[model samples]
Target: MFNKWINEPKYFNKEKETIIIESDAKTDFFVAPASDYLAHNAPIYAFDVQGDFTLECKVRPDFKAYYDAGAMMFYVDEKAWIKFAFESTDIGHPAVVSVVTDGASDDANGEKVDSPSIWMKLSKKDKVIGLYFSHDALEWRMVRLFQFDVKNLDKASVGLEAQSPAGLGCKVAFSDIKYTDKAVEDMRKGI
Candidate 1:
């Protein structure tokens, strides 16, 4: 596996098999609509991936503020990317959040998770991308299923991200990292 960072974090380390990233204050990767707001400073460690693949990891975020997250990212440049995150939400809950960016971001908050750490899965097959979360890493629950198309998509970047949009800083730990070249047969089932 190749290690590449889009935006280098303040601190990062590999503890045994786990990757830890410390996000800086007010760092994010969002492009808001109708405003002069664009944040692409959050740290992302990624590698080039082609064809179809599934990447899954167990993430534990030191969530102290709203929107602090540990994320699985599928990136095709700064304007076209997708982030599926286990995020601390504004409503005082930890939730599954997704932001699909095609020039501008379309953010959605999904199921609330009552855990400190959760398993996140991202799978890509053709033009379809699947997002799922799990408690035990066996039975995954669907978070989002959508179609995304971009130029040179087969050579896109697939990896991990750490963001702290509204806080001083956040530290996220990602473990049990697994990647398979084979994509899931069923997007809804995430099999």
Candidate 2:
């Protein structure tokens, strides 16, 4: 089961066959060493994650502004965490982005896709974590493969997130949710 959101969203449910998240305002989670603005205010729909497990969801954002995104997040603390987002890029395209923060957030962007909707997945095997995105749920493309070192990492928060960092807000719908107590065998394999 998941805990209540960090900053509760407009709507949330853990018992549904499918899940949905609708968020408002400029909510985001980031530790920006450059600006001295550690913005960890995004509405996080999270749960305890232990050992080897995979967390995934499908997100469809009414992306109307640059930098707006819906993400799959893993939080160890404000200073150390990760977020994989399906965001509206500055070039006016939807792209996949991965942000890993040890001290300051290292933001990386993947290819710009042609859809407003995408599926994001996170696999945790020990300290290694893989992030992937898919146009459809059947085939997945790797975004980033990395590792993190966190003390008492087990049961650390992992879940769905949404942000409107450069706009008023956006409606992000997340569905087809699954939290499995197993590793995604091949991180590069299709779902």
Candidate 3:
């Protein structure tokens, strides 16, 4: 029921290839390339998930732009989705743990720490979806929780995205992607 929301996939055509989809602009499909040293954009992948599910992926940023973002995306149209990422402007700058929803951006910038690997785990249970993040694949933090009108989540196809507008062609690598109905209760309690 949600497949119509996604457009054809676009690839980077590099050795560590990645795919980009043109989401329906009318539904909230847009990507912000790095505008300056202060901002880098996040890409969204639209889906219609209404039940308990989990999406996890690995991301490696190639450039050092402020707010350089990479994360698993859960898009409701174009204006709505959840992005969990590690962003920083430079090497000396602390990486911020951030999230954007309903066109509003919030971050745990002061809680910055070193994380070589990042995973975003989104779960839908009882009409509410929880957004969580982790480092070292073990400890997870509850970044936020929200509700959406999603119902046919399982039928949705997740997409991979990377945006490094400032570094023009600065690429991010994504791997080990998995979508399942696995229980994330333990992760939630630790948050």
Per-residue CA lDDT of candidate 1, range 73-96, in tens? Answer: 999999999999989999779999
Between prediction 2 and prediction 3, the one with superior TM-score is 2
lDDT of each: 0.92, 0.80, 0.48
Residue 74 of model 1 has an lDDT of: 93
User: Candidate 2 — worst ten consecutive residues by lDDT sum?
Assistant: 11-20
Say which candidate scores most in lDDT: 1
lDDT of 2 by residue, 1-191 (tens): 66668787866554456566666677787777678767877788888777888988888887878878888888877777888899988876889988998889877778988976888889988898988888787888888877788766875788888788778876678888888988798966624
Ranking by TM-score: 1, 2, 3
Please give each candidate's TM-score: 0.97, 0.91, 0.62
Off by over 4 Å in 1: none
lDDT of 1 at 156: 92
- Expressed as tens digits, the lDDT of each residue in 1-191 for candidate 3 is 22432433223332443333221111222343333122223344445554567776666655445444454566554445455554544445535354454544343443455665466566666556676666755777776666655444444444444444333333456655566765466545423
List candidate 2 segments past 4 Å from native.
11-16
